[model samples]
Target: MRNTLLVLLFMAVNTISYSQNQFTGIVKDAENGEPVFSANVYFPTLEKGDITGEDGRFEIGNLPAGNYKLVISSIGYTSYTTEINIPAEEFEILLTPSAIEMEEVIVSTPFHQLQSENVMKVERESISELNKNGAVTLSDGITQIAGVESVTTGTGIGKPVIRGLSSNRVLVYTQGIRLENQQYGEEHGLGISSMGIGSVEVIKGPASLLYGSDAIGGVLYLNPELYASSGETNGELRTDYFTNTRGYQSSLMAKTSGEKLKFLARGSIAAHSDYKTGNYERVTNTRFSEKDLKAGIGFQDQKYKADLRYNFNRSEIGIPEEIGIQSTRKLPLLPNQVIDNHVLSLDNKFYFKNSSLDFRVGYQFNDRKEFEEHHEHEEDHEEGEEHEEEHETHEEDEDHEHEHEEHEGPALEMHLETLNYNLKYNLPKIGNFEIITGVQGMYQTNDNFGEEILIPNAETFDFGIYTTAHYHISNWDFQGGLRFDHRDLQTEQTLSEGQLIEGIDRSFNSVNGAFGVKYKFGEKFTGRLNLASGFRAPNLSELTSYGTHHGANRFEIGNPDLDNEQNFQVDLALEYRNQHFEVFANAFRNSISNYIFINPTGEEIDGEAVFEYDQQNAMLYGGEAGIHIHPHPLDWLHLESSFQTVTGELENGGYLPLIPANSLTNTFRVELENIGRNLVSSYSFIRLRSVFDQNNPGSFETETPGYSLLSAGIGTGVKLDEFMLDLRLSGNNLLNESYISHLSRLKPDGIQNIGRNIMLSATISL
Candidate 1:
């Protein structure tokens, strides 16, 4: 039955009628009035796109008679999008130089358009800007975005929290594929590194209509670096240093592009010692080191395009323990972890006479292992005497003794493999509407080879189908979509010493949808309203786990009869902008049915508290507001401030766990000129951030006090004839204020946050 339906869908997508309305355009640079060659020109409604030739001209011959959304973009330039009528005369499009916050190209949505043209708003940040914040990890840098926070175990490991949701509820995409790295655990951090990435795109609300399951909270999209300009080759070397942890990082990248082919490569390495707290004391076993490499090759022509890429990451991270003595060690002691991740993907785009299609496939492998120290009882022995020699070597002598005596191997090891596939088609223009239909899925398996087991071996399969559309009118944009998904999971019955542990087979299905509209009130104001539904299937750890959680120091038991979680949310946003000032606000409310969470039972298992996974009805609501001002007399002086807050509560009265505290931040910046020879565009800024006390406590949760931090930074760029150099110096937590974050996993132990530290970074490009 499924095969028959798929065949019909393919047949409908391939059937198209050609048209005769031709549209021609020329692209040029706005600053210098020069032709911009190799620029991209596209029409989303017509499903037609092409790249400019040497003369910066492109012609699409088969566009139907209708209103279309046309976009033109090039490297190092802001994207331009406008509504146009078919059968029109030739037009000219001008591209401006990229600014600090340029108009971004929206991904994760079916249609590609500029942020202003998109019906649903998205948050974007450049990699260069994130680096300037003195962030040591990708997860840490993203916290700078309003309404976003990070749950940290230490300086080296953390996870992203969107509003009041995190862990498996949040989804991450890299290399155009979902990342799977056993993320349900409190100690598991995001596996991908920030090196070689171009930018980050975030959808702060549910996006299940496009991304399917596990997108109940939000989506974090990482875009890879763009290919070099036609017939261009470039290379860069970057390095950074951190004073608090005595850490260093370095990376190198090279890329080249030709008329029909392109290639790129990047490699990076980072190492850090144990971090120091605000009290001037070192936290034991908090050090970590990482190595990452990425490479890609691509080929494109008039009708076809294909790209292949690969990424590899390895990390050696230490697990903190209160029993260990304080010391500034560069390597972990006894209990530590070694993890490696590899990903390979292939993306292909095919263009027909009046339509286009895209197909992507990816494979990922993750290997994780944990090592623990083995204790031995004291025994009296003669000096230099050997009393451990066996008289006769038996078949199981060494193996039996090692298991019962002193063992020297990994305490737990797990290997995970996943394969993903996606197929999407854009239908030809029909009136003033553009429609997209697609299918996406994944097949995965997990296996363990260790004495201690956390989750049983399991196999998971998922499938989803969706259809989305966009309509553009005079001053209004409309978007809506519907999606259906199903997930099937099976686990082998666990057995230990002739005792049964857990086994399960279950299937979950859901139907979700979204509708949104954006209206331009005038040239200086805009408004948007969106309503969406999302769902999430239970993860392996939440359904079959049965072990001791070393990081939380507790016993965890999973419920096999758990059901899927469903959510519905409404988002409203408003913005007002002009030459001197800009302000924006976003408000949202989300209600969930059958929300899954772990709760303490007031019971003990083997001298540790027992926590069980359970379901409950919950609600969350929040809002974020910000403003930016640049004085008229002092154009170079800039001021910005923002506030974010969220409240989560169960249906009855109790609050939810792991909710972030409200925060407010203010910044003052000024531009400088004539600093030195060959130097231009020098700038500096001072920032203050205050976190409010978390008084709304959940069951078994405690209240946390508030704290304030002050920071500052300065940076500049220098031009050499054939080489360019960039330098920055930043001071974080300059006040060295002692504080504990409510979302920190180590808060129970009274571990203070990082101390005052200095950071330096430099980049040389050729």
Candidate 2:
């Protein structure tokens, strides 16, 4: 691992080179051919950008020979994007007046196109809209998206499930880097705060050609807040409160930019008490708290760009068991967790005459500790029997050592470190085609420092190379790509009871590809069809775990010879849009070979049931449909409805576990424009969601009952001179309905989901 880090660092330093490539352009207003000054010009793919001078002229040099996307934007103009071939000497660009809301741009995929222009369809949501739904956590907010669900252990721990797959099947990307925080664990959460994020994008099908392994289900890409415009400074303060858990959250952010330099900083704190059920009964030991901080800086010139960012997060969460006494205590009892995470990233881009080169490196560290009560046996708890013989015997008995301090430290502690690297080159365009080639890799290590051992100490190395292309012809776009990946894993040897336990050393490789096309039937209709193949290497836990899992109260045995799980999927999407109405539908089918899962052995080990990891062929299919309409006479009144369904089954027979039940949701929203004397904008909405009963459950899984939930919210924004004040009030399950979610891990414990949550938040921007 050390050698790998050194090599990556060396490459980052040596990748820079001086070239004669140069690009120059002039920006002007579309309505009037007047020069637009100080406009920001950038290349999302290359990460090299510049600001137009006072004369509306910009120049960048040392560019590599390649095809790139150039984005131009200003404070009062709509963002403009177009494909640029580097060798061109000078060019002219125009910006139009900013519309009420411009089409969102997606950065997760390589295309970097607007939502309406991309060959593949992706779902997007802004942070403000996510908060309007009154969710307590980031994962909770994401569940509002159709076809997306979360697997929850408690109120504070959640793992995203896409198209009925999760736990090492779904991938998460943040800060332009992959997140590696022991995602294979069921109790592990996303470990990210939504404060510093600007928006989120989701791809509902296989994306392995873009993001290596574990993208079989999908990818969740988080886009950080953009820096303030050139020569401008801005800041915001916000606070929130939730009644269900008595939680409070606060955050502050500041950003500034200059001609060639930019910087940003943010901090947030949150705390919550135990959550209450529909019957107003407290579920004890469900409390959690978090502290997060982030900072970033960047420097840009005509030909070179460099940016660095770091984030630190600390969280303390409690694990819930049987219902205990209802209390408002802030601290939890025994059986809790302390997690700390740190991420650092650097992005560099170099521009040549007709192409560009990009290099990104990231380092992440995660420390997780689980604490539980340690009870001593009667013989070991002896005290006050101070006879000379007894004292001598106790002193000589090695087993009695540290008997009084058994409960002082955590029962299980694991530290994980990961380093990731990527190098990509944008090849010069060929006729009407754009091409990209890249190499991605990672090196990781995990070590245990406590009594409990879930998985053995291990080291993993991964590498992949891919090539993708986009071809444009009239009103149709074509995209396809292929990738090859290899992974090697090794675990340290261990001994139990003076007997050697076999060590594992293995390697796996695979080939994957994707092809997709987008066609515009007319001005108001578009359609997309994509077919992709993805794979997931057996995780460390599935291959090396051999011990008691305290969180699940079971003994687990791993299969050292487990092979990679490969999947092939087909996705179809259709959409129609006009001024006042829009509708969309997405459908997909996936087949997997060697799907890894735990199987009950019908045996007991030291009073705990034994389960072993195994493999089987599986299939999944699902679709989501939705429509939004605004009546002509009452444009302020909006109506929307959506339905989502998915099912997974083994090739032989039974269904899969943790599959979300078929569900439908509807919303009625009203836009309050000029309703108050000082209000600039305001809105209110109500939603009715229904979940159908899950009659088809996997093996060892029971059926779930159907239920309906009601929720509503109101928000307004007031402007005072140059400052703005925003306030929102929202409620979930207003009727306090008692229901159990089919995807909740707590279902087996007979615990109902949280109910009747009232949230209030305020924000002030300057």
Candidate 3:
């Protein structure tokens, strides 16, 4: 009888075990047949799942033995689901396009437009690219998103341009604060830098509602890393040493978590003397060096959480000092150009049962100093000999006269101080209806004491308030926002005549807004229509400036009576995603009223050509589309490719200046696992880039030619360990291409980029 009881017990245990079963599978792209790495695989019944590893492999243990449904998803791709009967062994699965079911969901939206219904596009194109500058900081990264172009400086600075709008027409924000820096002047374009950003979000079109003025081009939001609710912290330390570039950089970041408090701290140090050209020649001051540091701390609870952050950045960079003789120009890339920044912010999130509040207040101060030695050209020329007689040799003779030693005409020190505050709230009063309102105020001052032009001192005050609403009703999503701005500027200057031009004041007030509606069909498809109106009051530098533009090597003259430039935009977007693939397309048209532009009057007034700032009606239009095919057939690697183009026309039908031509970027990455003791390898399989030259050269501009660049990266044998290493090998203008960028100086010809170079990087965790 005991033996019979034991048999019955064993049977009962087996029956219970049989109730649960395990499921395993591999995922791949349908078109290219590549394995999907890091693809999300989830089971509704299980409520948890694992991501695909290299070789497109995934295994889920301890699943109940029964019928189940599975979901797969990835960014920039479609989400997919399938039903299966699970036994025990591994199974291979495929996902279909989400477009079929999306057509019925045209009434749904993830976020609402702030104004009237119009089409718009939002993109995160820099997530996996190797070149960080082109992705997150300033405008360089957004240039690859269709209808976008970037105003590129040196290796370190860049800004985005949408359609044909640039400068004051663009609005760039970090997290949500309208970043403060002198973007209006190329000189200050490199001032506000983004060293460590997680992602860059781009919204193309007018964004006057939630964001005030200067949003005529588009909006670029820099997203930072956040702590999780579990109170678990994670971080990384990276160090890179490059040869041809002759630089060493080290970065450290840490995060800590607890039930109620979490914090993050990051610091980086980098210094490099100079860079070498393709011929292996040192490129002097072209090699600027510096150090950066950032820190943040926060606390979270079931209802609310708050964080505090402080950032300190100090650097001494190389600012090319160029001189022109006759028709040839030579830039001495060896001098040190110094600039530094410090910022402190307090941010908080308040949560209630059905609503939430997010707020941030911060203070920023930027101090900049520029010094240059005027190199005597040692040469002079007369106008057309016929005109020479009219011009006379007296003017030419004085030009060649011996010059006295001077400190860059006179040392000019500029100071900018800003105070900012903002608050946004979400309410559950109307179920899916939400509203956000906030205000921002700033005070900026510029002091100049130079012996040369002795530009007077200036001060600027800016204030604005904005509101936005989001409503979701059934299959449709609606969004809209409106903003009002008030600006006051004061300037004082002394002319060559020794007369004091004192206390010039200007003020402007305007309103801008955007509205859009989103529709969702079933689950796989989405479509949006958006229309927006925005404006930008003339900036301080635009209205009252007497300085030299170093990069373009031009003597800029600011227009004091300039009126506010206005923007109107319309955008259309379509999204189709599922499983291993996602395809997106965006198109837009923008029109500007009183669009400000630098027009060459040809007549040289005083010592420089009357290249005065002027305004005219303008228009811009363009579109871009892309597709993501993960794990085409391969299971251990990933590939992403994109291309963008733009076109702009002045009301007079003239093409805009300094507009970037067509460009393309392609990246390949590979990740490994389990070489030995959880060791893994991360590698950049390949990177390819191509840029078209700006053949639409201006009167003072020289034509440029298109070129291509190729690069590759390889890492150490193990990545899973606390320490990982990477080596990068690259060649810019690989063909030894001698092509000048659109922003090159206007002389006989233009300068070229570094010929070729190599670099290596490493990261560690504790």
Expressed as tens digits, the lDDT of each residue in 192-233 for candidate 3 is 434465556666777666566677777766655544323345
The deviation in Å at residue 276 for candidate 2 is 0.5
Which stretches in model 3 have alpha-carbon errors above 4 Å? 1-120, 125-149, 192-194, 227-235, 277-283, 321-336, 374-410, 449-456, 493-499, 547-552, 605-608, 631-639, 666-677, 715-736, 744-749
lDDT for each residue of candidate 2 in 377-409, tens digit (9 for 90 to 100): 224332332322343344334223332333576
TM-scores for all predictions: 0.88, 0.88, 0.75
Runs off by more than 4 Å, candidate 2: 1-43, 46-101, 376-407, 495-500, 633-635, 672-678
User: Which stretches of candidate 1 lie above 4 Å from their native place?
Assistant: 1-79, 83-91, 94-100, 323-326, 376-407, 496-499, 633-635, 671-677
lDDT of 1 by residue, 1-766 (tens): 8568557755754574435667888888999988887788877544456678878898776455656678887754667888777668999989875422346567667787787777888888888877787888898889888888898988878988998999988898998999889888878888777998898888888999999898999998888887775577889999999999989889999999886688999999998876777877666568889999999998865455778999999988888764234444455554677889999999877655446778888999999887765663212321112221221232134224434532566777889999998999888867679899999999999998877777888999999999999998888999999999999999999963344776788999999999999999987799999999999999988887676777678888888889999999999999987656789999999999999989999998778888999999999999899998876666578899999999999997799989999999999987755467689558788999999999997787899999998989989989788887999998889999888889888888887778888899999987
